[model samples]
Target: MNLDPALRAILVCPQCRGDLTDDEAAGGESGLVCPACRLRYAVSDDGIPDMLVDDAQPLG
Candidate 1:
């Protein structure tokens, strides 16, 4: 399923509440990152955010 644009517009990183942008660089799997916290949240298959720190895999 595609991500909800409205939800994406308002979504922020849970750790820092910083603005998030589409992580197209990480393949089609969408993700958001907080520059301040250097934390990234991955979008689940169901379009829900997996905002756990452990869930974020380090960028290669």
Candidate 2:
């Protein structure tokens, strides 16, 4: 599925408050990442962002 460009334009990393990118290969499966904080947030089944701190996984 094509990602919403508007969503991409607004989304920021919850941890670092930095810009976010659509990692298509990692999209849905691994969610989004904050390059600055190295945090990974899970994307919901409905494509909503689950931005809770506890839900974020440490980057590799």
Candidate 3:
């Protein structure tokens, strides 16, 4: 799902409260990534981002 530019600009990491960036290298599995906490947040097929902390995937 493609994320909205406006939403992406304001969306922060649920764990570290740091800025997030879209990582195209995630092979479409990870939509947003928090560099500070090394977490990847997934996006639904409906274009909604799952920003929940518990649902975040750890970055390798």
Candidate 4:
């Protein structure tokens, strides 16, 4: 699913409340990565972002 640029622009990390950037290789899946927190927020096939902090995976 293609994420809208505008929506991505407004998205922030739930943990650090920092900026999120597209990370296709995140945890071997598509996701948004928070540089500050080093976490990966999953983006579902339908284009829904899982912004929950607890569900985020650690970035390599």
Model 3: how far is 60 from its true place, Å? 1.3
- How many pairs in model 3 have backbone atoms within 3 A of each other, for residues 3 or more apart or on separate chains, i.e. clashes? 0
Worst 10 residues of 4 by lDDT: 21-30
Which predicted model would earn the best TM-score?
4
Candidate number that wins on lDDT, 1 or 2 = 1
Best by lDDT: 4
TM-score against truth, every candidate: 0.67, 0.71, 0.80, 0.82
For residue 47, what is the lDDT in candidate 2? 72
List lDDT for all candidates, in order. 0.71, 0.70, 0.80, 0.83
Model 2 Cα lDDT, one tens digit per residue, 1-60:
243568867889876789765554444373777888877777765677777878888777
* Candidate 4 TM-score over all chains jointly: 0.82
Give the runs in model 3 whose Cα sits over 4 Å from its true position. 25-27
Stretches off by above 4 angstroms in model 1 are: 25-27, 58-60
For model 3, what is the alpha-carbon lDDT of residue 53? 87
TM-score of decoy 1: 0.67
Error of 3 at 28 (Å): 2.9
